[model samples]
Target: MDAISLCEQYAAEHGMQQKNGNAPWRLFFRKEIFSPWHDAREDPIGTDLIYQQVLHGIKSGEYKCDKEEELASLIAQLYYVEEGPLEVNHLENQIYKYLPIFELKKNKLANEYWTGSIMYQYRRQFGVNPPDVHHVKESVVSFAKCRWPLLFSRLGKPSRNTCTIQTVSGDEYYIKSFNSQKIEYLILAFLNGLKQRSRFVIARKNQCGDDSNDLLDFEVGDLLELINGVCGKELLTETLVRGENTKTCLQGFIQSENVYVLPALIKPNANVMIYADNRNDFNRSQEATAYPQWRFGRDVLDMPLLKKLEGRKEQCNDAMTMFMFIMKYMGDHPSRRNRLSTDITDVIFKPAIAHEILRDELYCQLLRQITMNPSVTSEEKGWELIWLATGLLAPSPYLLKEVVQFLNSHQHPIAFDCLNRLKKLNKGCSRKFPPHFVEIEAIQNRTMQILHRVYFPDETNEAIEVESSTKARDLVCQIAKRLRLRNKDGFSLFVKVREKVLAIPETEYFFDFIRNLSDWAQNINVENSMLQINYQVFFMRKLWIDVKPGDDTNADLIFHYYQYLPALKPISRRTFGEEAENGNLPSHIKNLHMIRKPLTKYFQCEIAK
Candidate 1:
């Protein structure tokens, strides 16, 4: 007589928020508060370590709670909508923060769906006149109370030797979907009760009748439908459908009239149970994961970029030419040099390697020079030989064995320091060799020497001097600050490359947006001059869902309205006469609006002037 529920029961139990109402899901995260149990008036504990450690553990993916993805989705729904619409697409980054690298890779596509799922919730709260976002679904679950219940019936004794159940309700399963086997086992436990459920059970293909090939993918929906079949104590051979329809029943019977030998699937004395929430549960485990791999960790982070190599790509004087760039850089930094970005390194390596300038032979030649040449062997000019391994040679695993032998037999300080550093790098028994990782974000970048122009919807513009590495949000914030716009969230920077319009992500580099246009335009059949003239950057209101009237005095609100007004598609235009009859005309009419420029002059005037 076992009664068990997995997701539903657990979620309902943990649904209660912390004692402090401001907190979100308890299991999702629980920040520590000063408790009465501890009597120190000052609460010697520094800034709520109890809960913060939980956050850190979860962020690192070391700590996990039941229904982790479900909890993450709930937390994401709660916190993500707090930002503007442009930032909504970037919630994938937030998902990474709360989920493990393994979990993110497993469900890499979840963000594309979930973000839009929660859009309606924010649209209501923010009166968000959101610019067109990528693939937002109309159905929103933000700020809405959700219920997750674990429903189950008490187990009854089997009669006539046919013990089984079929059909299940999908709604009660708190976790909408589960990827791990542990969760599958939990579903089985919930279905059969902890006492009756074994490590696993298999449904016989022959016993399943005509639709024998179908198996439930362990969905709780069909699992619960079994409850409908299991109403009474008398067991029945229920019809188990698959996929859109399904059933669950225990295999406890046998046919004495059939041929003597038992089949391989079921042991002679054991039950021939049939399970499956959907058609693929039996075959699901055997299939390979088709999702994208977004796994990230220490193994993937770029060390040089972390230490230095940001914008230094340009510092290698332009005169070095593609042919001698690597040589000059290596000669100058004879020692370890700062890591350069991939774009810069690719240019240097691609050309040099293509022309056989920095080939395996040249690398081997350098090794021979350092170890064999009489003057070098005598320890004179030893540093110059060591410098030969700088940027280009350091990355390769070549001559590692020879370097080890030289260090073992000889005592040369230059090789001992430089080659040893090189040796320490190649120490691991790696399968793929040195470059098994990507560079991390650089420490910082230099300031740009030029001013960038931001254009408004009305065709007017302002020029702002920003850092070379400034991000989209920073640029928007600068515009908002200068204009005294109190409402900055509704504004976004839209980049028009030729005819294509792209909204720059909030965290992306402002100049990188311009650089990307140049990069992609290289493939176009158009002229370089055409590419340069086609792209224009501007600040405009892309989302007009805001219902709040603009403030007359706040430049922020005025700027927001000026950009937002032109985009109104006018589903229903309210004429001034209609507004007057309705007594609403005075509101906008009272303000002393700025003088408008004629379209002829507006079109000709420089946007930034």
Candidate 2:
């Protein structure tokens, strides 16, 4: 018959209906048959023709099998045929001559989908009792032994057809087969689980082992212990059984094949069953517990900078380059000035790495820029720079000094903010300041006073120089001696400078006196007397005070002259007395006092000569 007629006959016998001419169904049918024909016109045989040829070839003895009955059964199974099996002993004998046993086994396993379909059909047709569960389990175990000898041996024996495998390091797995047909499925599932959930192991050889106790001999049956993670292969594995009791754990990779599922002789424990679920969590907990205990125990100063920078070369270089770029960009872009500020306060100036960055001159320059940029400078950034500079005080004194000087002149709030920072930096630093630093401190004190006036106007208006009561007392004593006050007891020294009267207590130190004096000096209505006291008591201590007789007033007129001036050239007394009486002396020096005799003895002697 023609191929089309043959297909019609087969369909009639099977009571099969043809599918509609849908593209999907046609495509699916062509794909299922593995047809080479791409289109209806390419090869007229098409999908239906191919199916007909295969069935006809089988029936006509063109195809052969080892067992005619089995071949017929398989063919009928594939075609959904309902008929007695074909008999062909001669074909069966011929087939066996060419196919080996191993090939047969491989082919059977390879056609798993067909085998599954046949089994389903058999169950539907014969209503077979579930193959003896015990027999199926035995078959699976036997297959496991052949396929995975090492893994099977580790499983001592099966309990209720279930196996529990425990590695020497305490990892556990359970394998069970309750149904016959699912044995291969269960084994496959277990293998997949093993691959997904396996942990790494490292092994090292035992040095004391004799020639007889070779490394290979330290196999599954040997005892082993777990240790810290190590790098390398062939090291002892945590799960390896050791031949002898020793303190060391083997370090190495445990071959998955070497792992076995021993038959569970008893029911599995709850903990063993829950192992898979909690293994990762338990591992994380172990790492968390162990990490803090592992200390490098090396001093920071002892660590070589080059060695520390070895693996971090790229990261450190990138960070430094990026920081420089940001600074350069900030300088050009005034509107985005705060970008540099944010970087210092939020990133570079962190306590952990701030010192490291400060050690670099380039980074110090960036810090200086951030501190001085009025548009972008903030109290926080200023403090951060101060902190970094303070740390650099010992290693880079010049850089620290530059940073302080820059901050001292900065109009930003940081100008004031760095005062406390420097104080703290200086504390406990034991290092002596360079001569220039004393001047720097004076400048800082003056800057702090200005900042105090601008930002903290309401803050207790006190003098920056007045730090202690002793300094305040010293200042008062100087004023007393200058005024020749013999009755110094119970007499308060009232300083009239501008509109403010600073009552200097006798017990007050020089610091308090200067502080109060500074406040008094800042008054808008300051008098000439106050300006004179400010210059002489706080400043012109070494200068000569020239006392000239006044033309109109009985009081002598005092004028501050250079200490280096010769007494012979002493100011013409006649000229200064008339000027003092007319109140023509500069307002700044108008309130000068008569020279104390003993202090001005040199000038007096010069005048006498």
Candidate 3:
């Protein structure tokens, strides 16, 4: 019989006065209110902590010398009268409830050790519908079977002189070893003292009473919170307490639960205002569509977006897929669409399988539509693609590249449109696709042809010299300081400033001119008379101006120059031609040649006294 029913049976045998004569059994059985607690301890056999105590008391039939009637009276006081009927079959019904059975009988503490306020605290905090204690203990035992000896082995090994583990928040911690015994006691005390508000423990050796080896402790940055496991417990310490504190504090401060609300959900609609200057009415709307919205709320807080989320599931999934495509086409502008990138915990992209989609159907379709439409100007085409690419339907990268190449080869207006699109695309991806992309030579020749026919077909190079001179005069004035002129010798100024300017070719022409000067320095030393005359003849590129004699102001007269200089062999430049076209270089190539030609000549030029 169970505890309550056994007491009732004994009371009946002793002829104890029964109220309502209902077998005194229904007073102690509310299955919902009577669930057992999970101990989270490392024991899986021998005895169940709560049930064993009751079993022992029943078998002994000793109730501190109280008669059966008195013991029955105590049970009645403990449980409600209406619950008496449920107690009659408690022993049979109780069989369904599980309990912890410790595996290690020898080292186990008495049942009393698991009793008192700890049980109450656990129920109040974690809830009454606990896991079957015995089954949980058994599972824990199974988990510990391999770990016990392994843990001891870890303890026995020499301390990791130095080692680190990286946390998800990007902080690395040096794992320090300490005596497990000392740490065990410290943990016990820390748990005991948790009632205090400012609960801080000194982690160094000698902080606690135990004289065992030093314990493990490490620093983590603000991005992540960490809680360590107690010696024998399996609770995720940080997740429980720290997470609770976070929720509680947020609740108190905000008076609402929109703490992690994403901007993509709230705030005003991010509408693209397309003002047509050509149209007489500024208010004329060509076409308008509200951006498909993705609102953030409570569902994504406990789990990431990668989890199987419901409500707006279609929009969320399409947003991600479409956003990836848009990024590949015109480069990512996450802020433009009010989208925030959250860390994806799940593996969504597998490179071996996921092909770049932008180079495929969607991109080609857009290209065709924009190009074949005679009414669409280049500017109109650009704006349309920008809207389309950044919209919820852009394709992936590998496909986008293929589409652009197809457009280029066909030489259709679509091809030119793609070229224009490439120009307008974000410069951040320029490294990914170099300027050599798009068949630049052909594009340049085409551009020059257009300029000749449309802009100045009849003007000879000499005929435009005067106009070009005026332009170059203004240009030289703008770049005088940047050229860093010091000596009257043009060669010295060019040599000094060439590298500064050449390092970034995209800078203004004055910079590009200096860059070309640096590149042509070696060629100038060549003995070819024709090359020298060619240098002087074409030197006055359209931007060059004749500075009249008396109007001098230390002005450095330089011209815009572009050349396809012989590609300098990288190894030759570094090793100063000491290594041959196909020979193993001597070891002294670095150290011994440190004072070689360029270095020696450079230092000599600067330090020549």
Candidate with best TM-score: 1
| lDDT tens digits by residue: candidate 3, 77-124 | 222211222232452333212122331133444233323222333334
Q: Give the TM-score of candidate 1.
A: 0.25
Per-candidate alpha-carbon RMSD to the true structure: 32.9, 31.3, 31.0
| Residue-by-residue lDDT tens digits, candidate 2, 32-145 | 212111233344334244444334444554444555334534443333332223224433333333223343466645344334434444445335443433333233223322
- Taking all chains together, each candidate's TM-score versus the true structure is 0.25, 0.16, 0.16
CA shift of 434, model 3, Å: 13
lDDT of 1 by residue, 1-609 (tens): 022234444545777434553223324333222221222223324323332443355457545446644545434433433334436656655645545566556665766544554444445544455432211211111111122111111223333333222332112323323333334444454433321211122331233223344433332212222222232111111122222122434322321111011112212231222323233232111221231111101121221121122444432222133323333322322224443333334444443334332333333333433332212111233333333233223434444565556555444444454554455334421111111001112111111134667777656777777543356888888888888766677668988876788998877666556655655665574454322335678786555443244342453334544543444324115546677688886774574254222221232232224
Cα displacement (Å) at residue 466, model 2: 48
Off by over 4 Å in 3: 1-365, 368-379, 382-414, 417-606
lDDT of 2: 0.36
lDDT of each: 0.38, 0.36, 0.29
